[model samples]
Target: MTTFPIYQIDAFADRMFAGNPAAVVPLDGWLPDIVMQNIAMENNLSETAFIVRCDPATDGAEFHIRWFTPTVEVPLCGHATLASSFVIFNILGFDGDLVRLQSESGILTARRDGDAIVLNFPKQPIVAEDIPATVTAALTDAKPSATFRVASRDTDFVAVYDHASVVRDMVPDMSVLGTLAERGVIVTAPGDKPGIDMVSRYFVPAFGIDEDPVTGYMHCVVAPYWAEYSGKANVVGYQASKRGGIIDCTVDGDRVHLKGNAVLYLKGEIYLAD
Candidate 1:
């Protein structure tokens, strides 16, 4: 029998039940991919990240991180990444200030900063495209100001608008959304708030998630777009998907700086009944 540690962490939530919740499971060895997917489905949360093979002292010491949802495995996940790092540093007795991982998306890093976990992610390059039928019907009232495509693991739809309120208060037709893509849709806009440069939401029916709380991979895309539009490298961002989050980001060439806070909610062990 094999046993592992499991955690229910609230990412971007300063307190319990306020931000997005992702399950973090620490494993010493690999678990069957099917089992990991099953665990995520059982958790029924937006995302659950499994960490196997950790070595804090090694060059890539944090762990090999993977994210899963009720329906599928994802290459990148922000809240789960934060939750995983929190469990490693705070709950698992690791004292390291920085965590790095080998993931599907590529090499990623997370650092402990007082109350939050900041992530260093690659910026997804954006090139303008005409809004397609898949995008036009998903959003009801407003037409997108600009559009971009991210064809990493799956083709993603990136929509930008003029107002954050529109982005913040959007209610999508999940039934139609679910049929669109495997990666979901990201609709964003510039906020009127002086200090806040951008606001956004993520909808992924392809991944079987209606919405995501705080997406780390998103900064990879949002940062560069906002950086150019705002004419600054730094950006103050917010994800207004029901359970909102605060993300501070900046663009550096093809890389992005994603800074955000995370809180550990529950911690325990997982026994593999063998």
Candidate 2:
């Protein structure tokens, strides 16, 4: 049986229990797809991140990362990736404060800054597309001014709105929405809300999550899109899921810097189920 260390961490906030929680599992080497998938299902969080060695000479471990929800696998997950790197450098034995991850998304970097984990991700730049009528129905309160889509292959809309309240008042029909697009939908709006610059919400009724607390991958596309739209260099992002989180965002050329605090919640070992 493969023995792996697992961690539950809250990402995007300094205070414990205030951010999105993700499970991190660092493996000495790659596990079979079925095993990794099963392990993710067992952990049962918004996302569980699995790591395997790639080019140890580059760092200490060449890590291939994959994210899974309680129900299925996801293409990209920001918070979990941050949590995984934190565990490797902080909890595990990595010497430096940064770790490079070879993931589904591509080469990504995570840096430990004092007490927070900052992720440098490729900005999946968004271009405006025609707003579909189906998308209008999915976001009841806000109508998208712009749209972009991303699945594993083809992503869907990065729907934009005029105001945060429009995003806040959204009452999406999840049943109809869960399967709307291949890559699901991301709904966002600029926030004038106190304590935050912007507020957004995520839904992938199809991906088996009703809402994601703090989404790192979505912002890879979102930060660049908004930065261009607002002509701003930096901004704050808040995911309005029930278990919410605040993400600090900065645009730097082709990359978007996502900054947030992550707290370790639980740690233990898992023996593969025979």
Candidate 3:
């Protein structure tokens, strides 16, 4: 029998039951792709992260990371990445503050900032697009004031509303949403509360997640756009999901810095027969 250590972490949260929950599994070597997918399906969380150790040392170590949803292997994932870093730095007791993770999207780095973990990710390109009738009907009740496409690791259509309530109150027709795109849509609005620059909700039926409680990937695009739109270098985003979370976003040149906290919810082992 083979046993694997598993940890469930709530990322982008200050406490339990707040941020996005992700399962992190550390591996000495790569497992079969099918096996990893099966593990993610079994976890049934928004994301499950698998990290294979490439080298071990006292300083920063390198690892190969991949993210899988219940249905598909995603190129990039934000909250799961944070959880993986937390496990490496806090739980695994890595000596250095930085961890380099090589993924399908590219090389991504996570660094410890006081109590929060900050991820350095490539900025997504945002371009104006004509709002699709199907997307509008599937995502919201009314037409968006403006629409854009997040062209990067994954293609996500962004629908911008005027108020945070509009984004918060939406109940998307997932059936229609699933059929329209390979990924899904992002519904966002200006923050209703002061100190909160923006608010958003993410849906991706293709990934087997109807709605993500908190998303770090979407903010890669959302933050930079808001920086240019609202003329703010640093912005705070609130994800108004059922289990809400907050993100501290800073847009640097060609890269975005995402800062959030993660808490360990459970630690156990998954046994497998050899």
Candidate 4:
């Protein structure tokens, strides 16, 4: 048997069980894709992140990272990336305040800012798009004011509503949403709470997640949209899931800096057959 270290972290939350939990595995080298998939399935969280150290001169990144859901590997993930950076900064004895990770999406950077970690990610630009009949039918009770799609990767549909209460009370039909061609759907509205600029919820049934508690990647799309709408470079977003989370977002040109806190929940070793 071989043992590998694993850490479960609640990203975007100040306390345990308040934000999205992700499993972080630091590896000496690459594992078979099937093995990683099995590990993700075993953890059964929204996402499991794997990291391998790389020579910056050769690989152009300090670490290479990948994110997997219980069912499939995704091109990008926000909360998991923050979790991995937490492990790197706190548990793994990383010396610097910033860590650069190479991923399928692109080069991503995480920096330590006081007690929070700021993830610098590419902004996912969105454009107005006609809502599909299936999506409209699925959200029959709470109709969206407008619909938009990510222009770059075309991964998710953005549904905009008039009020935060509509977003908070929405009950998505996962069965119908899972059949959509896109990876997921995001519902958002202007924030109703004090100090909050916007509110949102993410549903990615196709990737094996019905609703993500607090998503960082979803904010990559919504932050820019809200910034443009509110005319503010910095904004705070609250994800109104059962386990809520708060993210502070700053939009700078094509990049969005996501700032949040993470807490370690579990630390142990994974035993696997060699």
Candidate 5:
């Protein structure tokens, strides 16, 4: 049997059950892709992050990271990246405040910001698009005023609502959502509360997630959109899932800094047949 350390963390939250939960596995070497996929399926979470330290003499990044859903691998995952960083910074006795990771999405960085971890990710591109009738019907009776498609490697649709309640109270049709061409759909609106600039909900039935509690990658899409709409460089987002979370986003030229807190929920070892 091969024993592997595994950590379950609630990302984008200060408490145990208030954010998106992700499983993080730190590996000395890369595991087989099928093995990683099976582990993610076993965990049955929105995402699982796997990390392997890069050779210090040859690589610029401290580690190489990848994210997996229950069914497939993803190009970028924000919450899981944050969770992985939490383990690295807190549990692994890493030396620095900033950790660089090489991923399919490109180079990503996480830094300590007092009690929170800030993730620096590439800003996903957004282009105005016509909302599909199927998407409109799947969400709710209320129509979105504007819609856009994230033209990045991880494609998703963004629907802009007029009110936060519309994004919060939605009970989307998962079966219909699964049929969309994009990876997922993000519904967002201007925040109704003080200190929160935007509010959002994420649905990705196609990725085996009916609803993501707190999505870090989706914020990369929404933060820039809201920044443009609000005419501000910083936008604070609230994900209105049942287990809600708050993310602070700062939009730079081509990057977005996502800041949030993570809490450890479970720490154990996974035993697998070798």
Candidate 6:
């Protein structure tokens, strides 16, 4: 049997049980695709991140990372990436301040800044598109001021509301929305409180998640969208899920900086029969 270390981390949270939970597994080499998928399913979290060493470097962090949901593999996942960075930097004894990872979406980096880890991710651009009435109807009694579709490869519908309360109170009909887009839907509005620039909630039933507590990846689109409207490069977003979390966003040219805190929840070993 082969044993591997596994860590459960709460990403984008200041404390345990408050943010999105992701399982991070660091591997020596590539595991079978089915094996990694099975592990993600067994974990049953929003996402599980797997990292493996690259190109003749055993200890170097030039790693290749992949993210999986319970049911499917996704192109990009933010919280899981953050959790992976936390595991590599804090738990795995990496001395560098920045960790570079290669994924399906492209090259990504995570930089440690005091208590929070700042993720440098690509900015997803959005364009105004005609609202899908079906999506609007799924969100009953919560009509949006405007709606848009992401122009990037990971296409997600964006719904804009006038009030943060409306965005929070939304109860999307997952059954009706599961087939709407390739990724999911993002509903957002201006923050009601000070120091909070925007508030958002993500629903991706197609990806086996009804709602993501604190989504780091979606903000790649959210931060830029808000910046164009608010005209501020630095903005803070709050994910208004049951398990609430915070994300500090900064838009720079083609990149979006997502900064948040993560807490370690568990460390254990998983056995694989040889």
TM-score of 2: 0.90
| Each candidate's clash count | 2, 14, 0, 0, 0, 0
lDDT of 3 by residue, 79-179 (tens): 99999999999988877988898888778999999999999988888788875797798777877899988867447888899888889889999888887
Q: Is candidate 5 or candidate 6 better by lDDT?
A: 5
Q: State each model's CA lDDT, in order.
A: 0.80, 0.78, 0.90, 0.93, 0.93, 0.90
Judged by lDDT relative to the true structure, which candidate is superior, 1 or 6? Answer: 6
List where candidate 4 sits over 4 angstroms from the true fold: none
Error of 4 at 108 (Å): 0.7
In terms of lDDT, the poorest run of 10 residues in model 5 is: 148-157
Q: Compose the digit string of candidate 4's lDDT tens values, residues 242-269.
A: 9999999999999999999999999999
Off by over 4 Å in 3: 56-61
Compute each candidate's TM-score over C-alphas: 0.92, 0.90, 0.96, 0.98, 0.98, 0.95
Residue by residue across 112-150, what tens digits does model 1's lDDT show? Answer: 888777877777876666666756567758888888877
How do the residues 195-230 of candidate 2 rate in per-residue lDDT, one tens digit apiece? 576778887767667777778877776676667767
TM-score of candidate 5 on Cα atoms, chains taken together: 0.98
Q: Per-residue alpha-carbon lDDT of model 5 for 117-161, expressed as tens digits?
A: 999999999888887898888999999999988887537888999
Q: How many clashing residue pairs, candidate 4?
A: 0
Candidate 3 clash total? 0
Candidate 3, position 269, lDDT? 99
